[model samples]
Target chain A: MNLLLQLFLSFFQIGLFSIGGGYAAMPLIQAQTVEIHKWLTPLEFADLVTIAEMTPGPIAINSATFVGMRVAGISGVLVATFGNVLPSVIIMLIFAKLYERYSEQTLMKHVLEGVRPTVVAAIFTAGLSLLNLAVGSISALDLFALAVFVAAFLFANSKKITLSPITLLLFGALGGIGWEALGF
Target chain B: MSGKPAIDLKFYLKLFWTTFTLSLFTFGGGFVIVSLMRKKMVDQYGWINDEEMMDFITIAQSSPGPIAVNASLMVGYHLAGIPGALISTLGTILPPMIILTFVSIGYQAVAENTWIKAAFHGMRAVVAAIVLQVTWALFKSLAEKKNILPLVLFAAAFVALFVFKVNIMVVMVAMILLSVVLSIHETKKENMS
Candidate 1:
């Protein structure tokens, strides 16, 4: 298969199969991009994940664009992004139409009520899996990193920065630099 | 322009620009963007009300694909139908594409630097903590809702994903089936009373 086509198909499958939103799509992405396709090394993946977090947008879209660009440059980015986004556009549009047309029908309401809790659970599981991966790998986790993690978590929850992702990541960069300077 | 009821170019541009600006800067995920969008699009501009935003958020969350795109699609559709959906999605994707294009091209140069490596190391571990915190917040909010089924389902979903390593599609399909069944049963019980 062509590399660009492969990139498109991979992300198309990813977007289509990514139930319960982007974070929940992480496992499948890892399986395809790293395990099956070897498009990236595990270490490269970790760095990409960091970049995704540090940058704006969801990890799935960010990774797809990054990987595609790495594979085939500008056209690759367009293909990968379109493939990743296609499913959401189609599905959400259909959903929006249906929902507007039939919101009062008890079935839709009940289905949604049931689905809501399930989604909450999935988000939790996604977060746990991310943490689990972090714990299992990464030999001798630095104490400075751990402190930064705690502080970041606190700052994230405390809403002290007035909700700026750049500000949050700037804190990470500066804090990390200081920690590295201290040899932690 | 005053009497023209149909939305024009200015409205489309505003929709595109609002989503473009929001997604270009916000991080974490769709959830973060959604909150910021609500503050701007909902509270500031009144493009959509709170309940509409909530509905869009829920649908966006439950559907397949990136929550960010799904969200922008839903909102755009609500505001201006199909064209709105396309334009909004275009806006949501542009920033990531542009940013990642440059990063992927230039990453090789910076990846080898010692300080950059150290910064990434610290950033990676901190990223984990941030995820854990999001999970904790999710759990607390869900718990506060006092929904037993979700709590139980949460455990079941975790075990299925972590312990069993089940395919997520399978888990989700099963959940949808289970939810429909439970809803039917609840309806029946209500009818009987």
Candidate 2:
């Protein structure tokens, strides 16, 4: 298979099957990029994961762009990103159309009602995992992280503060640097 | 819906710009972008209400792709049309593409930076916090409905995922089927009355 075509097909399959979101897609991405296709080495894949986490956008898009660039430069980036996004565009458009058409129906309303709670639960779980990853264990809790979490949560919920997500993220970065400077 | 906004170039640009900026700063993952999107689309712009946003999110999560991109497509389509969807999707992707291009070039330097790692460490906590806030908000909204099913489903789903480690796809399908059955039962009861 041609390299670009291979990249496109691999990512397109990833896009099609990545059902639960970015985190769920990680193993699949790893398998294709590192093990199966050998597009990236294991060390490079790990670095890509870190970069993906630290950077903006979802992990899928970030990895696709990074791996694509490594494989084939700018054109690779475009092809892979496009492949990853194509399924999303198609699936979402269909869903959007169906939702618009059937949203008023009682059955559809109930279905949404049922799904919304699960979505909440999923988000909660994602948050917990992230917290666990960041803070490590309860016994060895990072006080700095805990404090930032508390402060950020407070600021986010406070009506008077009007803090945006970007500001909060910046604050997090600054706090980290400040903590490190203070020898913590 | 009445008073629908015209699908004009200005509207498309606004949609593009909104997703672009959101994508640019969105750390963590799909959920983080969602919270910011709610703030921008629902709170700041008044483009969509909380209920609609929640629906968009549910659909985005259930769809096959990045939730952020899926969400952008849904929102853009909802507000404008196909063209809006295309533009917003473009906006959501461009930032990551641009950033990663640079990062790929400087992979060694970035991968080895302690300061960057420290910043990310701090940012992770904030990301978790932001997600917690969003979860709470969604939970509160479901609570306000005064319905037991959603509440129960929420608890059950949480347990299923966190405790038992069931696959998400399985949980989603089961919940959808259960919802459909429950709705049918309710409809029958109403008809009887």
Candidate 3:
């Protein structure tokens, strides 16, 4: 198959398998782009991952766009993005019955109770991995990230000021720019 | 309270309308959608509740698609008929598809814009923060019960990803093994008791 076809097929499979949201799609996405298809270098994949996290849409959508752009330019972007989304569209349309039947199933409830923690663990792992990469082998910024993390943590628990995530993001970005300018 | 009348076309139309509009405003991800869906459907429309919503989330996650899409299908199927499911799913996804289409078209024009990039830089932190918050919430739910098996599996999965650099399939296999073993142990303990 052509690269475009492969990207489409692979991401379609991703869409088919990914449940919960785009974030749940990350492990498979990273594997396909970085390891399986070699569509992106690990560094590039990491960068793409960061970009996806930052973007407004779904992470799966963002990854599809990035990988598509990388592999086949604009055409690649369209194919992959569509491929990623198509499965959701098709499956939801066809298998709507499953959605109805399974929503109230007892087995599903138990399984989800089991899976929830694991999913949480996986996401936490993803966040930590991102932190590791963002700080590039862990120095003061690692600690700084941790402090910011704790602040967010405590604030969330205390129900204090509903600190806009946007504000924290601005501060982090300014800090990054300042450090770079200061040659840190 | 008097027993409410059974469903009607107007109810279906309202469900479809609410879900579609909700999709347009959902910026971050399904997390944002969760709260919004709760507010609109449960609080506003009295369609569902906290427990039912939790069930919706669980079912959506266990299924094979995006949670938003899955939720739409389920919610729509519940509200209306098969046609309702189709319409609701379409309504939920159509906006995002249209917006992304425009994004792909003009991607290059704005790709290098400084303000866009700066705003994105801010958004990244928000993503991380929100994801972390959700993860923490899940963690508390799981750990509160003190299920040693899942806790072990959680730690093992993390180590597998972080230390051994094992593949996700490997991690998944380990998780399955851990779950099966725990189930067997639980059975054995029950027999003993």
Top lDDT prediction, candidate number: 2
Provide backbone clash counts, one per model.
Answer: 0, 0, 0
DockQ-derived CAPRI band for the predicted complex in model 2: acceptable
- Residues B71-143 of candidate 3 have per-residue lDDT tens digits of 7776666556677677777677656555555554465467566655443443344445555676777678778
Once model 1 is optimally superposed onto the true structure by TM-score, how far is the C-alpha of residue A87 displaced, in angstroms? 1.9
Question: Quick one: ranking by lDDT, best first?
Answer: 2, 1, 3
iRMS of each prediction: 3.2, 5.2, 4.2
Q: After superposition, how far is residue A98 of candidate 3 from its true place, in Å?
A: 5.7
lDDT of 1 by residue, B122-184 (tens): 666556666666667767876887769777877887788668877655676787688778777
lDDT of 1 at A54: 72
Assess candidate 3 and give its lDDT.
0.63
| Model 1 misplaced stretches (Cα beyond 4 Å) | A17-22, A101-141, A150-171, A182-184, B1-11, B35-58, B145-148, B188-193
Summarize candidate 2's per-residue lDDT along B84-166 as a digit string, tens digits. Answer: 78898999999999999899988745755878667777777777777678778778998998879778988999999789877
TM-score-wise, the better of 2 and 3 is: 3
Question: A1-184, model 1: which lDDT tens digit per residue?
Answer: 9998999999988898676565567666765687668998766776787788778888788888899988888888889888988888877867876886643336545655555555555555555544544445367655566666667777777755554544656677777788679865
| Tens digits of per-residue lDDT for model 2, A1-184 | 8999989988887787566676656645765787678988654664465567568988888988988998998899999999999999887877776786643356756766676777677767766766676677899998888989989889988889977666887898888878877777
**For model 3, how does the per-residue alpha-carbon lDDT over A67-95 read when each residue is reduced to its tens digit?**
77656877887788678867766655554
lDDT of each prediction vs. the true structure?
A: 0.75, 0.79, 0.63
